[model samples]
Target: MTIASTLRLSLYGVALSAISTLGLIGCSNSSTDTAATTENSSAADAEKPAKSIAITQIVEHPSLDDMRRGIIDELADNGYVEGQNLTVNFQSAQGNTATAGQIAKQFAGDNPDAIVAISTPSAQSIVAATTTIPIIYTAVSDPLGAKLINEDGKPFQSNLTGLSSQLPLEPQLDLLQQIKPEMKTIGYVYSPGEANSVSLRDSLKQALPARDLTLLDIPANRPTDIGMATRSLQGRADIIYTSFDNNVASAFEAMTQAANELKLPIVASDEFSVKRGAAAALGVNDYDFGRTTGKMVYRVLNGEAINNIEPAVMNDLTLYISPKHAKTQGVSLPAELLKNGINVDEQAQSTDNK
Candidate 1:
């Protein structure tokens, strides 16, 4: 082989080695650029905010109003602030069932993340309106009997769960018996459309018989009918029992006035009614119930599956009595009853005073 031919072959080998080195460098640069791009994409995804949720409420009553406040407060505490990360649409039925149903249907159409129904009628209407949306109810009585849930307090095939306001009937009846041992016949005024009232009436009927007493039920369909129904029981009953019937409660003044005229003491199922004119009440603190319901809302909005959470009962029973009504009706509450009284008006004379 000649020296010149050998030098040409060495030059060709050097050229191939240089080309391979350049190719490797170019591939390394390409890989670096791809890694940087992937990292940027991940950072962008992390910076994006989560989805916004909508919460709808059905009514504007005091108990329900408190519940709404609780939910809003809870949402804010859990990083879901209204007008920022969340949207809240609150509507009121004004004690009208038809309007409640309409509001529920409209709410369902909006496809909110969750719905919080306040009362039995509102919950029932919402349940009827949508089976897909999740419903969390408060201040409802006997969800099982109302067909809102199953016997085990599980969601009713749909995504419905909530807290119940089923205050114990036996306690209230027993308290009434304690306050007025001689009282054999008690009058109960309720609204026919209210499921809570119906359940309470049935419970009272069942409870009173065991105490050797009779419950005189007066069913009123509207607020106007309450006065007449209550008046019908004027002389027949020694005392009157008022449930948390919205119809009866809205016109509480009328019932109290009638009872005052007849000199009949009032026993109620809520503190608000007791403040109005009921001599005493063995009931639940509705505001506390609201706070509890708010916690449940927090769990659901935090992505916790509601199916795993059982329905809760707000069983904090409190006894309240009005000294004004007690004195006006000539009914003396026991010392134990007065101990649990929330607001006792010792100075404010009863309207029954001449």
Candidate 2:
């Protein structure tokens, strides 16, 4: 009677053990299936392409416009069409710093892939607006001085890189001497708010003494002040020097008019300034500056780290001469310089009838 009861209990225990083992196997299979489904979903998400990038520019001036065009052109060439794989948002500050800052903030709000700043102010504003969005700046002079980068010209703990329009000042100053050997006092006009302009002014002042020239500072805080500043320098300066100040550039016509009235020849940092009224200017082409900026944007947009990219400088600079202004101011350029001039012929023809 004891053996029969013991065998029945053992059989019941074996049946329970088998049932538990099958239940464990079923649970394991279900868990494995769930994991496989999750892995497949994750792989699908990983294969989906990322969203298109949004790019913003600070202002809309001739130089900045050229830069924007260059960027779009490059993007198109790379198959990142504006409406397709890329979304470009271009806004202009119209020379207003506050407006630029607002635009920067707005661009950052949209979480753009990158921001393209055209000038120093724009770049600074963009940098102030965001610490993460990549920035590509063009036509900025002395990014270090502008506080847009570290002294090494590297990104300052953020994603920022671009080109600097710091053309060699030596050649420009030498041209001044060539055009007006007796020019003792050269009047220079710049905007104080511009770090690049301030830095350039210091360089010019320090270099002028060695050339036996005195740099007369004509400070114009805004575009409207340019006319008065140019008038103030009428008789005080034998020649006028201009920097790539946005304020001054915006009112170059007024300054050039005053200089022409005073028979004061002008030398500028941009060829377009020379075309307006300056006697001569040595500068890189704005279009090319824009093109180089575009290449930087391409690199950054194509997955390269902005911090790892180095700032670029234009390789070629052209000498531009205004024959009309030259004749009016009684200045003559070297024959070689005239031959290589970018806008001499048109200037001469326009002046011939005048």
TM-score of 1: 0.78
Please provide, for model 2 over 1-354, each residue's C-alpha lDDT reduced to its tens digit, 9 standing for 90 to 100. Answer: 211121111211212222122211101111256878656544543333343454444445465566677767655544455664567777788778898889889888988778888888888888898889888887887888988777665677467777776666667777777788788998988888888889988998898888778889888987889999989986789988886788888888889888888888888867677766778877777775665566667666667787777665553567777777788776777675566677665856789989
lDDT of 1 by residue, 257-302 (tens): 8888888888886766776787887667766666667666666665
lDDT of each: 0.70, 0.71
Candidate 2's error at 345, in angstroms? 3.5
Worst 10 residues of 2 by lDDT: 22-31
User: What's each prediction's TM-score?
Assistant: 0.78, 0.80
What local lDDT score does residue 121 receive in model 2, on the 0 to 100 scale? 87
Clashes of each: 0, 0
